[model samples]
Target: MHKTLDKLYAGIGEAGTGRSGVGELCALAALSANLYTLVCVAPWLDEEYGSAGELRRRIRKVAAALVCRLERETDDLERVRGVNALFVLSNTAAEYEQKMLDLAEPVLGRYEAGRLTAEAALFEAEVCRMMCNCYCLVQDEALAADARTIISGWTAVSPSGTEGLPVGVALARCEAAAAYADYTGDERFRAVRSAGDYGTEEPETICRMLELHLRCGAVSDAEALCDRIEQDAATGTDRTSQVYRLAAKAACELLRIKDAGFSE
Candidate 1:
């Protein structure tokens, strides 16, 4: 498997440069898809069927080579196309993806050049989906940092290309921001509020904003946001089950806290 990946990488490197033919693009795309398959699908087979131990090991090795290839390709794409590094991560396994993210977090700077789009907020949201769903055990510090970078890159427009994200990406960002604040004891609500790139102002996002305001003791502001949320809900725009339910409960708590003067 490692040898197969090596051949693919070599072919891509050779084909990626000084090439203007469909063959080059097709080869690179095949590598991307195959790499994604290995990263995303093989592990599931191993865990469920236990029929591919040796193949899984080779998959791990392929991941290492893929990381290296991503570095060079990201640089090349950054200078030329701005769309290569992420393809390596595009279809990777959730758990393996988490491990790769954890491994790559320290060296993320190396790939920053390749991730230059200003409308990558949705992409970051996808990252959060993987983190919350599969990499629940990952360290918050790394996740928070990645979120900060991705959010900062976003435009203040509605979130774009969010169809592929988890249903709760916005809410997770709120939790991430709050966690970042708690973890570093620093103010980081900016990332939470930077949901413009999501293309849609999800009910969950509004709820998160309200939650953040309430957490910061901004009673009037939170209440005002609640009014906005209610208006949206009444219009049949805001539709989320778990998040809306949770937000309603949180609102009640905030009301009680305000009445009791728990925070002034």
Candidate 2:
């Protein structure tokens, strides 16, 4: 048990260079998704299953097509906990960089140099935020320092950056950019608010801003921002408008999307 923890700790250093391709980043992203199950979901398993060995025995009674299972042998809580707690935190930054590079590589290799498309930058921002959450989960926050760097790469501007783009992609970029400034600390909010990259008044942007303000412990400001979104939402009566309203409502609760549960 001691040796296992020692190994996890020793491997905590940054792993790969930030040069992974899109396909490779995609693979790591998938790994992170599965690992998320163990970290976030496994712990919540109803110890109702009894001892770990009994838990394994009961799991074998299932007849569904589920792709995962708790370990079948050992019952050591420390070892079970250590694998999930440490694995992602140890390599989050490296995976973040690779995902960032995957977004940047195409722009660099093609007609543009160093410029990021709104869609690509948005995905990168998502990865950055995901890394921050994962690091925070394990109490290893040093890697979250990448938030500022990641946001800075969002050179794409709305209209210009989002020109001719699908409505879905544009909306997602708004959320991602808003979150980028969010995790960057409050000082960035004003800059991002006024930057008009994804457009400041967007409900998605406003909701994210509200959540950011809440995260910064400014509940009053978040409420004010939520009100502003509600007011601005009167500009349309289309389906998209309705979607924005729903997203705003959900985003108002200071919720963070988490892993899918593995336990019944």
Candidate 3:
């Protein structure tokens, strides 16, 4: 892990000093994405490697360096990706959450009012997902309300046949609704169910729907989803298949606990 971190840091440092050409910017973006994934899975890495504190320190350093490089970036798409990376990093390093939010606010405002380019729409959806995730983590009423407004705006403008909605937009709405449901103890689970009906077979989306079903005491539905996931895993032949298999196992355990009258 340290060797990988060293390589990532060196790449960022080299890119930071170069002229911000497309190649250099692409390098920085790739580094940022790698760091974001590292932060997201930091807990599991810590468990596996047993250097939690030092690993976290290294992650913080790399994230800070990447953010510094991105601060000088001029491209809107790259800037949005940088912000999203920072948001993911902040989840692992909670102290940076407010700082990330402050950074994102202006960018989000620009995208919100801009003409509806594909990039602009993507930015809004990503920001809405960030806001919803933040609200779920911290239980901030204002953030939740703002996220709700963005989601409502999407719904208001969406065609009656939501099947035509872009997959990214639909997934974002599904996640946002799931987050709201999580915060409110299943109050918005119906919204999650509705948003999740866009014909996506994404594993994360399926897992989220399964979890929400459990939250709302829909044991039969959750079991069916769990069975589907397990069946897919059984026939699959990739890393994702293993991930789905583990998720299914965990879901099964959760179901057992629920049936045993244990608090989740």
Q: What is the C-alpha lDDT of each candidate?
A: 0.41, 0.36, 0.53
Q: Residues 170-214, candidate 2: write the lDDT tens digits.
A: 443334445444444535522332222334665434544554454
Top TM-score prediction, candidate number:
3
What would the per-residue lDDT of candidate 3 be over residues 1-264, giving only the tens digit for each residue?
Answer: 445434434544442343333333333333333333443444454443225565455446545654665666666555655555565456556666666566656665665577433465555666666666556556778777777776667656653213356765555455455556566554633343343344545554565466556655667776777677666635544333333344444565446544656333
- Name the lDDT of candidate 2: 0.36
Which is better, 1 or 3, measured by lDDT?
A: 3
Who is ahead in lDDT, 2 or 3?
Answer: 3
Instruction: Name the regions of candidate 2 deviating beyond 4 angstroms.
Output: 1-118, 139-142, 145-201, 218-221, 230-243, 247-264
lDDT per residue, candidate 1, 1-264, as tens digits? 344334433433332342222223323333343333433433443342233444344334434444444435533222121122223333442334544454444234433545534234433444433333222344556655655555444323334322244545554455444544544455644345433333334544454455556665667666666555555544323122332333343354335444566454
Q: Report how far off residue 157 is in candidate 2 (Å).
A: 14
Which candidate has the top score in lDDT? Answer: 3
Deviation from native of the Cα of residue 213 in model 3, angstroms: 11
Model 1 spans with C-alpha error above 4 angstroms? 1-120, 125-175, 188-202, 228-233, 237-246, 262-264
